[model samples]
Target: MQIVNENNLGEFLERKALKCKEAIKQNASLLNRFLNLCLVFDECKDDLDNAHILECSSFKELFLKKAKEEDGYFKITQDIKALDFMQLNFLVNQCANFLKSQGLKANDKVASFLQNSLEFVILYFACFKSGIIFVPVNACYKEDELAYIYEKTKFNYIVAEDELLAYVKCDVLKLAKSSFLKSILKHKKDFIMPKINPLDLAMILFTSGTTAKPKGCKITHYNLLFAGYFTLHQIGLRQNEVFLSSMPNWHIDLQATALMPSLRANACFVLLKRFSARRFWQQIVFYEANISEVVPKMIELIKLQNKFAREKKHKLRFLLYFLNMSNEKYLEFKKRFKVDLFTSYGLSESIVGCIGDNYYEKMSYPAIGKVFFAYEVIVANIKENKLIPLKANELGTICIKGRLGYELFAGYYEDELNTKNSFIDGYFISNDIGYFDENALFYFFSRNKDLIKINGENISSLEIENLLSSHKKINNASVICISDALACDKIIAFLELKEYPYKEEVNILQKNKELKQIEKELITLNLRLAKFKQVSEFIFLNHLPRNYLGKVRKNVLGEIYGRN
Candidate 1:
């Protein structure tokens, strides 16, 4: 990846600003498209071959026909079982009947604690057909985390893998076994369809807990459908496109970007059990996938791959990159690969916030782009009880309100107080800190809780983290707040070196030089920061800790560093 020299950084940023402003003027029509969520599908042509969902008999009818059709095949599969659409439908229908026979009613919560196999996909669709609410649990959750969710929701039934059964505190059904499918098949093929509504709960997505317990966010049928429409419109995905799905089902991005969009566009999605950095490019080339979803951490690992030919040999048109990396890192990857990188600003609470692809021409790296269709977003000073709107180029909490009860989530499941507190005057408080320029391009900073206050100044941890990441030797950086001797919070920076030149057998003198080199880089970094914002201390580590979703666990860092 190429890095711009300090001499050109200022010029590059200025040019980016000018280009963004010009692009905003040119893409005025996109704003109108953004306001009409339901009509987005209308933009697709009426040609049966061109529209995946509309041309088909129905979503349910298309499920089984794809496998039997000469052109259709098992698009979603894994090492365990490569299921064609027929097999997928068989399992989904059987599972739906099994759930009905079990006396589970519509809107009943069914926890899916299975691995990333075809069974998981089958159960997801089954829940939809049967009108059962799908609640996917991360396969990696420990017993305590699992227990927390169980106590909160009181799920009517749970479908879990045999290996993970020990974590289930209550009775559960095993997936991927013949006996279960046989029992399901014994029931009638046709089942009563529940009265459905767009506002009815379809799924309950739990947050990737950082400090507190995970809170379940209620997602409605309309919410998921709109998310699919927004994704297709934002990413420019067309019919018959191929998407690579590697992230877990628990993540909203996987469902929104890959699963839901594929269903909407009649596109093919290649599903993997888990993300494998070594196998990612090969799978893309093998399946001829046109689009891929990734986070910054995945890109960092991919950048380390020495197979240069794989970088350009695939059919990848672009990658949906979540905005978390520094500007330098983002630009370096984009420039080195010469691949289209579309970034979006969003959270699990809302499938999307501001989308960058719509403003591809005016889009600036490290910027969150513009607001999504029909979604009103603004930065407000939440610290002030009034939640007054912030002006252009001012940083504050990001607040979003969708076409009332449509684009956004329903609320936190069973937590009325927290849910009520999350909204004010129709806007859902996102606790994330960000800002937008006069041209409406948004930029994300650190979370509100991550801000470091020292000497009467509020320092953004992301700012220092971004500067540290710009250093050539630093691979990644995480900045956290620590209590200082001055009775205020101070910034503690944790860095992972790009390469460790010293081996275990290396002499002590050489190891000391390696340490000195890192210290020297920190000294250089301090020069670019304000005196108060300068890092109070530096801690080098082999790697930074990450949560289940690959987000840095800064609260864990705080706990670890507090005692030290």
Candidate 2:
């Protein structure tokens, strides 16, 4: 006689579905059609045990339940091996016990410093079970970058591969043995779950550090789940579908786009070690994948390869892109591959900043779709204590508010000063500048700060300048973003020589040697930087443009020498 379940899960689902419906009211008919289709299948209770179903509170809960129900459920495919849910759960249990034995309690920081593999996935869920904060450090990070993160968090444990052990200066428990899986299986699978809450810190995602040092954005379990469910509703992803994911694990979209949505929809996620133009379509066809996450640069690279035949042979419904693309390229891709393109905008703080294509209504090529459900977005002037609303098509700082407790990020991890500075009138201030059209579709213009986005990676101009300025021969240096066709921007460095008109210039061969030495020093400095953060080109200048206050005029440098 009860329409809803006793645990209020049914009620929660209904409320969330209603919110989704209201958010996409423009496509109400489409929602109704999808709902009707969902009713055609059994309600997933036919074979699952009652005990397994009772513990389904979060994604981790649901994953554990599914593992128990169908021990052979093919959940993940990496390389050529398909791992069942039970096998993956066993790994998670072992990791949880390992962390527990190390005396790591709830909210203890555990740094994940490895590649994208089954082990990385295990560490991810292990943190969820043990109530440890998961800090994602990209595997390719150099020693200096890794040292900074270690100094800030002082993590209690680190899970890394043996090859990357040199970067760890902290005296934490380093599990770098290649035979870890064999050792973990010896541990008992029965481990106690920690007491966790929706508000507990789930992750500490460091931003690109456009200003100075990077600030870690604190995210909660509820925030991740909310973004996952919202993505599921917006994309209309069907159950038992395959999702092809090649994005870096450190990126927020990797979770928001592939992991969480696939778990919520009960789908299989195909994880690639890295993006490869040659193997992309082959893997898609092999897995029969229905969705893929990509960037504009990848698309351009695919087209350059001229793999036209393979592009249309697979069953991809759409591709998810983050940055903007020209209308010509968007339509050309649709015509060639017979798949829709969904472009979006989001920062490390909020995974789902703006909704991509919903497939209900037609959207402009580059317009990022409407604001997500349960979140209010506005284009307004960010004053000291208030937000002044702007008219349609008027450029202003993008702001968002709603359900900050459960739907938004918590705050910066340890920096109280930055955490306090990022908010105004209880709204999260997105430093990116943009405006909304009359049709309510938002378009991105540029970052208000001098942050450079290159090939889906955020690079700080100041970070580059600081590195280049360390050279003894370089008196000063400036870094700026220049338009690039492949990635969004190419980093260019302009350096001023400490001593000009050298006597070596009188001798041609000696001058050439001096230039080569300078180039070698710059390249050596680049070895310390991440691949995406490396300077694309360097230009030597006698003097750098500066103002009366001795501030380097970066904009002037961009105009004078940024024409690439």
- lDDT, candidates in the order shown: 0.63, 0.68
Model 1 / residue 366 / CA error / Å: 1.9
Give candidate 1's whole-model lDDT.
Answer: 0.63
**lDDT score for residue 230 of model 2:** 72
Q: What is candidate 1's lDDT per residue for 1-564, written digit by digit as tens?
A: 111121221122223334434544566343321211110011111232223333343222333344221111122111212332333445566678888878887878899887566567767777877778889987666565577778887788887767767777764543433244456656654444566666678889887322234678898777777766678777777765677767777777778777776655546566766666655665566555788877765777666666644456667778877646666767777776667677777777776544465723644566777886767888998654567899999989889887433677888889888788888877888778889999888888876665553422335566677778888888888887665322345678877777755343311122367767777878776765545567877877667777689888878777768656
Candidate 2 achieves a global lDDT of 0.68
RMSD for each of the candidates: 16.9, 10.0
Reference-based TM-score of each model: 0.66, 0.81
Reference-based lDDT, residue 81, model 2: 29
TM-score of 2: 0.81
- Segments of candidate 2 deviating more than 4 angstroms: 1-78, 308-310, 383-386, 403-405, 483-485, 497-516, 546-551, 562-564
Query: Residue 307 CA error for candidate 2 (Å)?
Result: 2.7
Put down candidate 2 lDDT per residue, 98-152, tens digits, no spaces.
Answer: 7787788888999988776666776787787778889988787888888888888
